[model samples]
Target: MTTDPREAGPRPPFPGEQQQERPGLTSKMTPAPDHGETSYVGKGLLTDRVALITGGDSGIGRAVSIAYAREGADVAISYLDAEQSDAEETARWVEQAGRRALLLPGDLRDEDHCRALVARTVAELGRIDILVNNAAAQTINDGLDDVTAHDLEGAFRANVFAMYYLAQAAVPHMRPGSAIVNSTSQQAKVADSTMLIYAATKGAIASLTIGLSNLLAPKGIRVNCVAPGPIWTPIQPIAKTPEQIEQLGADTPLGRAGQPAELAPAYVLLASREGSYMSGALVPVTGGTPMY
Candidate 1:
């Protein structure tokens, strides 16, 4: 039960984390990132509730799906149509834990699709007690000249617009005590030049989280965010170069990339009754990097 923190998860120098697409798959990576398949014991903290998780096909979404299921919440996972294989695998894990898993695939950039994601979850899963806005888009740039209008627009649509659309659609269906957990990033505060679009959108998400928390407080809905440092997710492979991927998370004081498994508990806590008094709180699981 006691493992060295420095050696908790896989370090950098990972081979072939890159994929030829925007949203990468989990199966392609060489030392597949752990999603707590054999780990993550639950305590029935979310018995009979339903959760809708964006980007639940892989990475942190997959991990959160597993944790939510094990904790007794039926989960509806959303992802791109291209990620059907990964979605099915994630659904299997949720079902293995004796909870229902709904696979909804579409583009989050569309407002109607974002609304549909909420409607489908409420209609199929009975109700949406939790909404996890975990899906986002990121791309690297050498300089301002390299940042294209299309990429910038797409990033804002997926990362920022989608959150607003989903929240608007989900709020009416949710009852008191429901929770919404958004996944922002450490890049929001620390600022990465190469990730201009990503950092900007993430910063918007952080601000939105605070405003949404207050907006929903009267209804007893909690809104919070998790700002993760460099993690060993498919996003790394797709967005960074081999050199950057190799040294990923090494700069963290912990000396390694955080695993998908490591981020799930925070989501669970935010959605559970234990976090009843917590709202608008941004919890940073950044290895040892300072978020504030």
Candidate 2:
């Protein structure tokens, strides 16, 4: 497995330590994830296609957004209002690839806003060819007792519910051969006690990807998911302790956390014509987590 020197070593606090909200920024990360290195060249795989990615402001979402743009797809990134700067930065990079980027900022928790997200993307880009359900929320807790109704609902809304809402809105507009990619987590399979609620939501997302794939197959729209293991993203600081963040993905077989750029290629494959036969599948970019 090829590894980058920048992502190798004792992890530092994600760049700017501004503890503002659930989803944070790549620009603010201590070591900014490589959105696209010069080695990643455009191949026009998704030429003339349009893509809408939730949480595209940072982390895996940003990586996927940049990859799609480089692959010849116009990109639209949906993020929270607080992440405007990060979202715009992603847009600039997407545009740098000679593709148009629509910056759609709003709360995915709102059903109406979720619908509007797809509408705006389609309106701006002409049509929606790819929909990436990647936005998610999580918080560490002691155990089941620590998991409250609000906490579960918030995680579900951000992680699973909005995925459903966004897919429902985008599917009709998607023509034959369109693709939808959801982001599940390794925790969904080997969940720790501290992340029970968050894991449950991701588990649902894995199932959702399967069911949606079957439902949309007749329409020629493929649906799949990328189950990431411990990745070094802003979510670590917001959801886990500083000490926990320090150890990030050390327990994995890779003995280190994954960078967002590493996972983006999986998304690119699923979103492009290359994955036309792939549907109802979960591709584990989990550092050898052994999903089976």
Candidate 3:
């Protein structure tokens, strides 16, 4: 079966009034984003491995959880307590994939909580072979004046600082050949003013991934990042206006928003043995959008 890439998934202008408050839910999405529920077919690429994915409750995190589980890795997910329902749903998918799933709910803004997520994953899942730093906090702003100090701190804490917090605690426990994959964004280079703070943090993550890869390379641990283009996930409705939601991913070269399922294979490649020589790499899965 052959399908055209541009029309492989849903295209815009999307239907209905898609809008929600912070920390949105998949159930609220009109067509509902696909997390590889019936699409991804694992080939035991990560068998016997254990993975810890932050923000694994939904969106890209959820999709990765399902893919990793099917690839034969036990999965642990970290999420804010408010998203427990979504988190449980993700756990279900992992379990259905015939792998273990651990749910850790807490705010990643706290360094202690970030460290604890790694600790608990190691304790319950046996060991962490892949750490996916996919959780993030994004807020749309009008301009510099609309951004506040607290807003900046919140974004950095959850998006950048927490990656360090978890890495610091997990690396020692991880063995050689382990990998750390992060989620940056196309906006990191494309530079969107409306999402200024969010884009800034994503840029910082890309830098950190490179520097961290160098620091961990000698230990035989690889680090990489994925810069996503416009993807359909709960994060869109939560952070964007209803108007923006309707036109989501309409500007992409592919002519449609990438789904969370579309982003999973990239995470899998970076975290699996197939990507052994891929450290410090920034893999772009932006629906043909360019990233420099």
lDDT to native, each model: 0.93, 0.83, 0.92
State the displacement of the C-alpha of residue 73, model 2, in Å, after optimal TM-score superposition: 0.6
Q: Alpha-carbon error at 129 in model 3, in Å?
A: 0.8
Which sequence of candidate numbers ranks them by TM-score, best first?
A: 3, 1, 2
Write the residue-wise lDDT of candidate 3 on 1-292 in tens digits: 1389887788887764878888988889977898899899999999999999999999999999999999999999999888999999999999999999999999999999999998899889899999999999997888678989999899999999999999999999999999999999998999798999899999999999999999999999999999999888989888877778888888888888998999999999999989999999999999888886
Residue 41, model 2, lDDT: 70
Listed in order, each prediction's TM-score against the native is 0.98, 0.93, 0.98
| Better candidate by TM-score, 2 or 3 | 3
lDDT of 1 by residue, 1-292 (tens): 4489888888776774365476788888867899999899999999999999999999999999999999999999999998999999999999999999999999999999999999999888889999999999996899899988999999999999999999999999989999999999999999888998899999999999999999999999999999999988888888878788888888999998999999999999999998999999999999999987
Name the lDDT value of residue 29 in candidate 3: 94
Superposed Cα deviation of residue 65, candidate 3 (Å)? 0.3
User: How far does residue 98 in candidate 2 sit from its true spot (Å)?
Assistant: 0.8
For every model in order, what is the number of clashing pairs? 0, 3, 0
lDDT of 2 by residue, 123-190 (tens): 87899999999988976789668878888788888888899999889988999999999999887798
Runs in model 3 deviating more than 4 A are none
Q: Candidate 3, residue 291: CA error in Å?
A: 1.1
